[model samples]
Target: MNAYQESLKIKRDNYSALESAELRGEQRGQKQGEQRGIEIGAELERAKAEREKREMAVKLKTKGMHIEEIAELTKLPIEEIQALV
Candidate 1:
């Protein structure tokens, strides 16, 4: 083949390689973003659950529940229950 034709083929191959690389990079970025979103969601859920547990502990404490019983019933640490008192 002529030099002109060979050069064109090389350019086409390079362009194809660049396109493939760009597509792979986008997919990797999307996956990473999805994973980050999942992590944030889990963290939010954990925070909400912790808040609810603390509220319940406070209510139980107001009702004159024993610290040890509150700890056992709520599955919270004894220290945490005592702190609420």
Candidate 2:
């Protein structure tokens, strides 16, 4: 190939390499974002469930239920349920 043509080919090669690297970087970023979103959603769900359990424990406590029974039914620590009194 002529010098001019050879120079053009090298330029095109460099551009293609850059484009491929950019695409790979974007894909990695998107995957990381998705994983983080999933983790946040799971954490929120766990928090919600814990809140519900505590509410139930409070209700049972008001109903004159025994502390040990409340702990077993709500899957809460005895000390935690006792603190609700």
Candidate 3:
């Protein structure tokens, strides 16, 4: 083949490879972003649940419920329940 045609072929191959790499990188980035979003959502849910449990434990304590029973019902540590104001 002529030198000019060979050069054009090489350029076309390089461009195709670059495009493929970019597409792969973008797909991986999107997957990572989605996974991070799910992780954040789960953390928020766990934090909300923890807050609810603390609130319930306080209410039970105010009602003069026994500490051990409160710990069991709230699934909070005995030390945490005792530390509640």
Best by TM-score: 2
TM-score of every candidate: 0.86, 0.92, 0.86
lDDT of 2 by residue, 41-71 (tens): 9999999999999999999999999999999
Q: Rank the candidates by lDDT, best first.
A: 3, 2, 1
lDDT of each: 0.91, 0.97, 0.97
Which of candidates 1 and 2 reaches a greater TM-score?
2
| Residue 67 miss distance in model 1 (angstroms) | 1.7
lDDT of 3: 0.97
Expressed as tens digits, the lDDT of each residue in 1-85 for candidate 3 is 6999999999999999999999999999999999999999999999999999999999999999999999999999999999997
User: Which is superior by lDDT, 1 or 3?
Assistant: 3
Q: For candidate 1, lDDT tens digit of each residue in 1-85?
A: 6999999999999999999999999999999999999999999999999889888999999999888888887888988878884
TM-score of 2: 0.92
Superposed on all Cα atoms, the candidates' RMSDs to the truth, in angstroms, are 1.7, 1.3, 1.6
Model 2, residue pairs in steric clash: none
**lDDT of candidate 3 at residue 81, scale 0 to 100:** 97
RMSD of 2: 1.3
Model 2, residue 80: distance off in Å is: 0.4
